[model samples]
Target: MVSAARTATETRTTTRTEARRAPDIVAGVADADKLTDEIAATSVDPRLWTGAFATNVWGGRFAIDGVLGEGAQGTTFQGTDLKTGGRVAVKVFDVGRAKDWKALQLFDREADTLKSVDHPGIPKLLDVIVDQETGARALVRTLVPGESLAAEVKSRGPLSEAALWSVIVDVTDVLGALHGRSSPIVHRDLKPANLIRRPDGKVCLVDFGGVGRMRESAGSTVVGTFGYMAPEQLYGAQTPATDMYAFGATLLTLATAKEPEELPRQGLSIDVEAAAAKLSPQLRALLTKLTAPDPSGRPADAKALLAELHAIADAKDRPAAEPSWPEPMVDSPFAARGTDGDFLVGIVGVVFGVLGVVGAIIVGQLLIPLVLTIIAATADGAQKERILAARARVVEAAKVAQRSFERSAQHGARKLESASERERDRAEHRRRRKRELKRHWKDEERRLKQLAKDAKRSARRDGRFWV
Candidate 1:
C-alpha cells in the first residue's frame, strides 16, 4: 500500500510539472491582445506557428510553416487548415482585446462574404473557425502565392505608367465586381501593398479586416491606405469615388515615387494637369477629376471607373481572342448588420459618370529611375535592381490592365449585340409598316385619277348633247 501511494504521488507530480513546462499557445490570433493581462510582441503570425503558437483565444496542435506577410490591419500567415491540410492564409485581429467585438464580427462577416463569393484572383474561402472558449475568430483562405505590389515597388522600384495602369485595372476589376453588386462593396483600403501579383501574372486583393457594411440606406467607415486614400476618405466620407481617388493616388505614387497628397499643388488645390504632367495629359486630367475633393466631382461608382479604364485600354490596344477570368475583391456574401464598430470601410455603390496620372520619379541631382528597393541588395551587385523591379511590375501590371480592359470590352460587346439585335428588329418592323402605307396611298391616287377621267368624259358628252 505504501509503495503504491508513493508511485501515484510521483506520477501526479510529473503530470503537473509537464503541464507547467508546455509553452503557451494562442490560436485564432496573430498579435498580442493589449486587453489581456499578458501582452506579447508580434514577431511571427500565430497561425504560421505549427510547432507551438498560442493566442489569448485558443491553443491548437498543428503542422504547418511559413510567414507570408504583415499589414497594419492584420498579419497574414502562411499555414494549413487543420482539417484538410490545405495551404491557407490566416488573418486575425489578435491585437487589442475585443475592441468592442468588432474584430470578431468582422471575421464572421468576412467569412460569410468569402463563402458567397467565388473567383480565381480572390482567394478561396476554405473555413472559418471561432474558438468556443477564447472567442477568437479567423478567416481561412487559399494562399495567394506571389509578392505584393508594395514588395514589387520596394524591391523593383517605381513601375512604368503602363504597368501601373495594369495593376490599377486589375484591382479595379476586383473592386468593380464587389461594388457592382446591388448593395455594392467599396474596398475601403486600396494600396499597392494590399495587392498581390502572382507568378502567373494575376493580381488579387487581400485583407478585409477593415471592410464595413455599406447599406443603400446608411453610412460607412472611412478606412484605407494613407497615400492612396481619396480626399473624401481622408475626411471620413466613404464612397466608391473615394476609392477612385485612392486608385489615382496609387498610380501617381508609382509614377512619381511621391505621395499624391504631397504633390506640389497650384496653390492649395492640386492641378491634376500639373501634378501629373509627366504622364499623358489626358490621363492627368482624368486622375485629377477622380481625386477631386468634392464627391460630386468623381465617378459615381466602381463600374463607371471600369468603363473609363476600358476607354483607356481601347485607345491603347486591340481586343483579346477570348474571355478573361474574373477576380473578386473582398469575396463572400452575408446579411448586413450593425455596430458603430460594424465598419463597412467604403460606401455602398452609387451611379457615376467618370477617373489619375502616373507621377515622375526624381532621383536627386542625377535623375535615375530608382528608389524603391526589394530585399536590400549589396551596393554595385546589380546597379538599379529596384528600378528593374519597378519597370517589370509596371510592364506586367499594364498587361494585366490591358487584359481586364479587354474582358470588360467583351461584356460590352455582348451588350452591344443585344442592343443591335433589338435595333434591327425595330427597323425591319418600321420598313414593313412604311411599305403598307405607301401601297395604300398609291391605290387611292389611282382611283382618284380614274374618277377625274370619268368626270371629263361625262362633261364632253353633255357638251355635245347641248350643241
Candidate 2:
C-alpha cells in the first residue's frame, strides 16, 4: 500500500512539472513564427537573404541589375541601392581572376583617389565593399547617366564643329580642376570611351583605375589605351602634358569617327596634320600643337590651352573689317548722289517733271531721257530690296540658332527636375515605411509586456512559478 501511494505522488509531481513548462514552449514557437512572417513581409526578394547563395554582389544593401561594361581588370555593374532605392554603379575586382598584382594596385588606387576628390564631373564614391570569403572588392558610386563618347560617335556620325567645341570646353574645364590640384593627378587614360556626356550636356570623366600622379617612378607598368596614349606614356613618362596628348587624340577620334591608330602616322607620332586636314584652321592648329611629338611642343597646361582657345574664339566672334568702299571718282556722274535715299527721291521728282515736259515734247528727244531715268530708278529700288532681304535672313538665322540652344537647355533642365522629384518621392516613401515599422515594433513590445504581466499574475494565483 505504501509503494502505491509513493507512485501516485510521483505521477502528480511529473504532471505539474510539464504544466509549468508549457507556456515557455508555446512562447518560443510564437517567436519563430513571428520572425518568419517579418521576413516574408519585408523582403522584396527573399533570395537576397541567403547571401552567398545568391548570384548578386554586396550582400543585402545593393543588388546588381545588369552589367555596365567590362575591362581587362574588372567589370562594372548597374546596381540598386536597397536602402534608398537609388541607382549606383558597382565596379567589382575579382582577385581570383586578376592577371597580376598590378590589377589590384590599380583597383586600390582608384578607390583611394575617388574617396579623396569631390567634383561634379567625377563620380561620387558611395561605398567600398570587400568580400572576405571571395576576396573580391567593389566600389559603389553614383551612376553618371549617359553613353560614352565612343558609343555616341559610333551610333551617331562624328559630332559637328559646335558640338566638338562644346565637348572640348567641358573636358578641359574638368582636367583643369584635376591637374590644378596641389599634387597633380593625371588621368593617364583619357580616351573617348572613358568620357561620358551626361544628359545635361556635361562631360564626366571616368575609369580612374589607370590614374596616377604627375611624376612616378621609372619602369612603372604602362597604363592607358594604346591609340590614345602619348608617345612618352609608353615609356612610363606620365605627366600633365601626357594627358594633353591623349586629349588631342580623343578629339581626333571624335572628329573623324575613326581610331587614332587607324589614321596615317608620321614616323612614331600620329600624322595630326593629315588626320585633321578636314577640320577648321583654328581647330587644326590646336590639334597640331596638342599632339606634338615632344611634351615641350604641347601647351604648358590646361590653363594655357584654354587661353589660346579663348583667343581663337574671340577672333572668330569679331566682325569682319567693314569692306572698303571705293572712293567715288571726282569726274564720275554717280558722285552727284547725296545719299541712296536722296538719290531715289530726286529720281522720283525728275519722273514727275519729265511727265510734265513730255506734253511739250510730244515729238522731241526728251522721251528717250525720261525712259532712261525710270529704268535707273527701278533698278535702284530693286537693289535696296535685295539688300534688306539678305539682312532679314541673317537676323532670322541667328534667332533660330539661339532658340535651338535655349530649347536644348530647357529640355535638359526638365529631365533633371523630373529625376529630382522622383528621388524626393522615393525618400518620402522610405521615411513612411520606416515610421510604420517603428510603430509596429512598439505595438508588438506592448503586447508582449502585457502577456508577461498576465502570466505572472496567473502563476501567483495558482501558487506556482512560471518558467
Candidate 3:
C-alpha cells in the first residue's frame, strides 16, 4: 500500500511539470509569429520606405543625415561615409520611377565624368550604390564645404571687383583644366548656382549633370539654363565656347544683381553690356564678347579667355607715374642721411631694376634730386660727373624698360586682335551652318504639311465615292 502511494505521488508531479511546459511552448510560438508579422510590415513595400531610409543609415555604409538640396534630376543628401567617417554628398535617384530615367542617365554620366577627371575645384566621386530592394541608384561624392556662388551673390549683393576677379580666376582655371583635357569636357550648365565659394576664398565648380565631351554626338533633348545656354546648345550643339557663353551670362548676373533671364534680351541674346553697365569697361567688353549671339564671337577656349582676363589684371596692376611720391622712404631700409649716399642710391637703383619703368621713375623722383644735391655740396668735379653719368644710366634704363612694356602690351593687343579675327571667321561659318539648318527644317516641315494635306484630300474623295 505504501509503494502504491509513492508511485501515485510521482505521477501527480509529472503531470504538473507537463502542464507548466505547454503554455511556455505556446507563448514562444506566439512571439515568433508577432516578429514575422512585424518584419513583413517593414519589408512589404520598398518604394514607400526607400526614401525614408535616407533619414537613417543607408546601404549599411552611408549615414544620411540631412537634405543638402534637390534638383530636377535627384535629391542630394548630406551624409556621412560610415566606412571612412567622413562627410559626403549622396545623390539618390529612384530608377524604378519612370520619370527618373533621364535623371538616372544624367547621374550616371556625371559619375563617369567625375571618375575620369581630377580637379581640386571639382567634387571627387567616392562611391556608387544600387539598392536591391528599390532599384534606386546613389552617387556618393566628397562634400564640398561652401556656399553656392548664387546664394552668396544673392545675400551679399554684387561682389566687389577684387572678389569678382578672384571668382573669375578660380573658375577660369577650372575651365581651362577641363577644356585642356584630351577629349575636352564642357560644363554645359555653367551658372552661378553651379559654383561654390569655399571659406578659403576659392571657388569650386560642381554639378556635372550637364557636362559633355566635345567629341560626343549631340543629345536629342535641350540641356542647360535658357539664358546661359548658347544659341547652338539650344539646337543640341555644345562646344567649349558654349561654356564661355554661360560664363559670360553668369558674370552679367553677378555684376547686374539680376538673373540672366530677367535681363533684357535682344532676340535670342541677352543684352549683357546694358545690364552690367556699372561694371568696368574691360569687364563690360568681355561680357559682350562672351554673350555674343554667335558662338564664334565668344572666346575660342577657356585658356584664351583666361589669357584675356590675365591681361586685364595686368593692366589694372600696371603702375602709372604719379606727380608726387606718397612716403618714398616709408618702408625703405636705407637711411636718408647716411654718409654712404652712393650706397643708398645703388640700393634704390637695384630695387627699381626689378620693378620696370614705374618703379625706376618713382625711385628716381625720390633720390635723384637728393643725390645731386649731395654731390654738389660735397663731391669733387670728377665725382659729380660720375654720379651724373650714373643718373643718366638709370634714366636710360627706365626708358628701355618702358619701351619693353609698351612692346609687350602691343604684342598682347595684337594676339587679341588675331583671336577676334578668328572668332569672326568662325561666327560666319556658324551663321552659314545655322542658316542651312533652318532651311532644312523649314523644307521638312513644308513637306510634312503637304503630305498631310494630300492624305486628307484622299480621305475626302473616298468618302464621296462611298456616299
Candidate 4:
C-alpha cells in the first residue's frame, strides 16, 4: 500500500508539470493576442504592420518593442523611461576603452541638449536613464518614421538633381530652426548616416549622440566625422560656421558618392568635384563661405548661411539670360555656367570632355563672319564659289561626322550594357552555386550528426550487453 501511494504521488507530480506547461501556452497566446490587437487598433497603415510593432509610449513609459534596424549603433531596441514610462531608444554604445568615459559623457550631454530643442525634423527628447546594474543608458526620444539616408543611397544608387535639391532645402530648414533658437544647436556630425528620409521624402536629422550646444567642449578631441567636417572643424572651434562647413561637406557627399575625406587630397581631376562646377557662380561663391578654410570667412550663423543659399537660388531664376547661339542650340542651362561647347560650331560634345556641334557653332560664329568678309573682299566669282563649296563640304562633313559619332556612342553604350548584364548574370550564377554548395555542406553535416547519434546509441547498447 505504501509503494502504491508513492507511485500515485509521482503520477500527480507529472500531472502538475503538464498543467503548468498548459498555462504557459495559454498565457503566451494571450500576450500575443494583446499585442496583435493593439497593433491592429493603432496601425495607421494596415498594409505596413504585418511584423512591425507600433512604438508605444504608454503612461510616460517608452516602449520600443519593434524591429531594431541594422544600423551601426545598436539603437534599434525597445525600452521605457523609468521616470515617465515613455517609449525610447536604448542604443548600446560599444565605445572602445580609449574613449569610454568621454563617449558616455558626450552621449549624456547630447540627450540633455536635445531636450531644449523644438523642431519637426528633430526627435523629441523625453529623458535619459542609465540602468543602475548595467550602466547602459537609454536616451529616450520620439520615434522617427523614416529610414536613414545612407540606406536610401545604398539601395537607390545616386539621386537626381530635383531630389538632391529637395533634400538640401530640408537640411537648410532644419539648420535654420536649430540655429535660430536662443542657444544655437550645432549638429557637429552632419553626414548621410545621421539623416533619415521619411515617406514624404523630407529629411529628419537624428543621432544627436554627437550634438552639442555652442559651449560644449567639442567633446575631448577632433570629433567631427571625416569628409563631412568643415576645414575649421578638423582643427578648431565647433562654431556655427563650422557646422555650415560640415553641412556643405555633407551636401558634397550626397552629390558625389566619394566622401569629403577624399576631397582635399584629390588634385586637378576634380571631376569628383563636378558638383562645384555645376553650381551657378552665386552658388559657387556661397560654397566658398560655407566651406572656407578660414572659419571667419564663413557665415556667423546657420540663418546667414541659409539666406545666402536662398539668395543664390533667387539670382539663378532672375539672372540675365545667357547669350544664346543659333548654331549649338544654346539655352539657359548652359548659359548658367558659360563653358559649354554647345555654343561653338565645329566642336562636338565629345566623350563628356569635348563639346561637339556646340563648339563648332561658337567657333563657326567667328569663322562664318570671317568667311563672309573674305567672300566680299574678293571680286572673283570662282573664289566665292570655291569658298561656298568648301563651306558646304565642311558642313556636310560635320553632319556625317556627328551621325557617325552618335552611332558609335550608341554602339558603345549597348556593348557596355551587354557586358554589365553578363557580369551580373555571372555574379548571380556564382551566388546560386555557393548556395548549392552550402546546402550540400549542410547535408553532409546532418549525415555526420546522424552517424554520431547512432554511434552513441550503439555504444550505450553495447555497454548494456557487456554488463
Candidate 5:
C-alpha cells in the first residue's frame, strides 16, 4: 500500500513537471501564457520577432519565417504557405497594443482595398487571419519579390536620370490604374521605402496602410509619412493630387538621396529646381507642379499626368532639329555688319576717285576725260558682273548641299523605321512565346496542387495526418 501511494505521488510529480516544461518548438504560440509573455517582452525590448523557431498559425497553413519590416500599423513577416509551399508576406496587427483606434481603421481599409484591386504591380491578398486568443489580426499576401527602392538607392547611390524617370513612369502607370477606378484609390503614402524594384526593372507598390478612396470622408488625423505627404494631407484632405505630391517627393528622394524636407525649399514648396538640377527641365517642371503647395497647381488627374509624361517621353525620342546656319554666314557682308563700316569705306573711295579723275584730266589731252569715263564704266560693269556670279554660285552651292542633306536624312529615317519595325515584331513574338510558357506553367501548377490535395486526403484516410 505504501509502494502504491509512492507510485501515485511520483506520477503526479512527473505530470506537474511536464506541464511546467512546455515545448519551445514553436514561437509566440507554444503556450498561451508563453505567448502573452513573449508579446510583452517584444513590446518592451523593441527587438524583432525573428521566428527562428516555427510559428504555425491557422492550423499550420502558414509558417512565419522572420520579420520583414515594422510599420506604423503592424509588423510584416516573411512566411510560407504550407499547402502550396509558396512564399508570402504576413502583416500582423496586435490589437491589444495598438497606439490608437485609427490604426485599426487603417488596417481594415488596407485589407479592403487590397481585396478590391488586382494588378501586377500590387500584392494580391491571399488570406486574412485573426487570432481570438491574442487579439492579433494578420493579412497574408503574395510576396513581392525584390528589395525596396530605398535600400537600392542606399546601396547603389542615386539612380541615373533615365533610370529615375523610368521608375517614376512605372509608378505613375500603376497609379493611373489605381486612380482610374470608379472610387479612385489614393496611395496616401508614396516613398522610396514603400516601392519595391523587381529584377526585371518593374516596380511593385506595397504597404496599403495609408490607402484611401477618393471622396471618402476624412478622418481627424492624417495618415502619411511627413516627408512624402502633401500640404493638404496634413489637414486630412486626400485626393489623387495628394498622391501626385507624394510621387514628386519620392522622385526627389530618388534623385538626391535625401528626404524632401531636407532639401532646400522655397517657402512651403520644395525647390525641385535645386533638388533635381541634373534632371531634365520637363521632369523638374513636372516635379514642381506635382509638389506645388496648392492642389490646383498640380495635374488635374492621373490621366492628365500620364499624358504629360508620355509627351515628355515622345519629345525625348524625337531627333533634334538640325542646327540652322548663322544669319551672318548666309547674309551679304554689307548686311551683316552695320552701315558704319560701309559708310567709312564709301568716304575713302570718293576721295581716291576724285584724286584719280583730277590726275587723269591734268596728265592727258582733251579726250582724256572721255577716255577715262569710258574705261571706268567698263571696269565697274565687269566688277558688278563678277560679284553677281560669285553670289549666285554660293547660293546654288548651299541649295545643292541642303538637297544632299535632305536625301541622306530621308534614307536614314527609312532605315531606322525598318529596324524599329523588325524589333517590334521580334518583341511581339517573344511576348507570345512567354504567354504560352506561362500558360503551360500554370497548368503544371494546378496539377501539382491537385496532387498535393490528393496526398493530404490519402494521409487523412490512412490516419497518418495530424493537425
Candidate 6:
C-alpha cells in the first residue's frame, strides 16, 4: 500500500505540471503564427496587403475602399471620409519596402508640397497618417475624378487639335500657377500618366511624387520616367524647363497618337516635328522648342510657354486682313475741261473787249494824229513838227496795248495747262492704285485658298472627322 501511494503521488505531480504549462504553449503558438503572418506580408507584393489596408482606418477618419493604382513608390486607394462622407485618394508609402532613402524623402516631399498648395488643378491634402502596426505612411487627398491622359489617348486615339489645345492650355495654366508660386514647384514627371482629364474637359495634375522645389538642390536620385525625362533630368538636374521638356513629350504623344518612347528619333532628340508634320507651323515650332535637347533651347518657364501658346491660338483665331483699296477719285471730264475753258474764255473775252476799246481809242487817236499831220502840212514849220510828234506817240501807245493783251492770253493758257496736268496726274494715280489693289486682292485670295486646302489636308491626316 505504501508503494502504490508513492506512484500515485508522482502521477498527480506530473499532471499538475502539464496543466500549468498548457497556457504557456498556447501563447507560444499564437506568437509563432503572428510572426509567420508578418513575414508573409513583407515577402510578397505590397499590393496583396492592399485589401487589408483598405479596410483599415487612416488618419482615424478615412476608410480606404480599393486599390486605384500601384507604383514604384506606393499604392493609391480610393477612399472615403467617415466624418464627411466625401471621396478621397489614399496613397500609402511602405517605407519598409522603399528602394532607397531618397524614395522616402520624395514621398515625404510630395506630402509636404500638397499640403501647402491651394490650386484647383492640384489635389488638396486632407490628412497624413502613419500605420502604427506596420510603420507604413499614408497621404489622404481630395479624389481627383478622371482617367489618366495616357489611358484617354490610348482609347480615343490622337486628340483633335482643339481638344489637344484645350489640354495643353489647361496643363500650362496649372504649371503657370505652380511655377509662379513664391517657391516655384517643378513637376519633374510631367507625363501623360500624371495628367488627369476630368469629365468637364479640364485637366488636373496628379501624382506629385516627382515634384520638387525649383530652388532645391538636385536630388541624389533622378525621379522621372525615361522617355519623358529631359537630358538634364537624367543627371538629377531639374528645373522649370525640365517640366517643360516632359510637357512637350506628353503633348507630342497626344498629337501623334504614339508613345514618346515608341516615336522615331533623331539621335538623342525626338523627331516630334516629323510625327506632327500635319499640325500648324506654330504648334510644330512650339513643340520642337519645348522638346529641344538642350534645356536652354526650351522656353524659359511655363509662363513663357503659356504666352507663346496663347499667341499661337490668337493667330489661329484672328481673321486675315482683306486687301483694302483707296477709293477712286471721280473726275468729270466736262467739268475739268469746262473749268479751265470758262476761266480762259472769261479772261480772253475781257481782254479782247478791252483791246477792242483800246484799238478804237487808238484809231480815234490815230485819226487825230493824221488830222494833226495834215494841219501841220497846211501850217508853218513849228506847227507841223508838233503834230508829227503827237502822231508818233499815238502809234507807240497802240503797240504797247497789243503786247499787254498777248502777255495776258499767254498767262491764262499756262495756268489752264497746269490745272489740266494736275487732274491728269491724279487720274493716273487712281488707276494705278486700283490695279495694285486688285492684284493684292487676288494674292490674298490665293493665300486664303491655300490655307483652306492645307487645313483640309491636315484634318484628313489627323483623322479628324470635323474640321
Best by TM-score: 5
Ten-residue region with minimum lDDT total, candidate 4: 21-30
Instruction: Go through the candidates in order and give each one's C-alpha lDDT.
Output: 0.56, 0.69, 0.68, 0.56, 0.70, 0.72
Kindly report which residue stretches of model 2 are placed more than 4 angstroms away from their true locations once superposed.
Answer: 1-59, 322-467
Please write out the lDDT profile of model 1 over residues 58-87, one tens digit for every residue: 224232243455665455556655554556
Q: Best lDDT goes to which candidate?
A: 6
Better of 4 and 6 by lDDT: 6
TM-score of each: 0.54, 0.57, 0.57, 0.50, 0.60, 0.58
Candidate 5 whole-model C-alpha lDDT, 0 to 1? 0.70
For 97-137, candidate 6 gives per-residue lDDT tens digits of 78788888888888888866656788877767775655677
Per TM-score, what order, best first? 5, 6, 3, 2, 1, 4
**Count of clashes in candidate 5:** 0
TM-score of 5: 0.60
Residue pairs with colliding backbones in model 2 are none
CA displacement after TM-score superposition, residue 48 of candidate 3 (Å): 6.4
- Candidate 2 lDDT score at position 97: 70
What tens-digit string does per-residue lDDT give for candidate 3 at 200-221? 9799999888777783346676
Worst 10 residues of 5 by lDDT: 45-54
lDDT of 4 by residue, 100-199 (tens): 5767667766766666655668776654544343244445566666778777777776655566678877888788767777877777888888888988
- Per-residue CA lDDT of candidate 2, range 82-150, in tens? 766677898767777777888898887887777676566888667777766557677887788899999
Candidate 5: give the clashing pairs: none
Off by over 4 Å in 5: 1-41, 44-54, 216-218, 322-467
Which of the two candidates, 4 or 5, achieves a greater lDDT against the reference? Answer: 5
RMSD of 3: 25.7
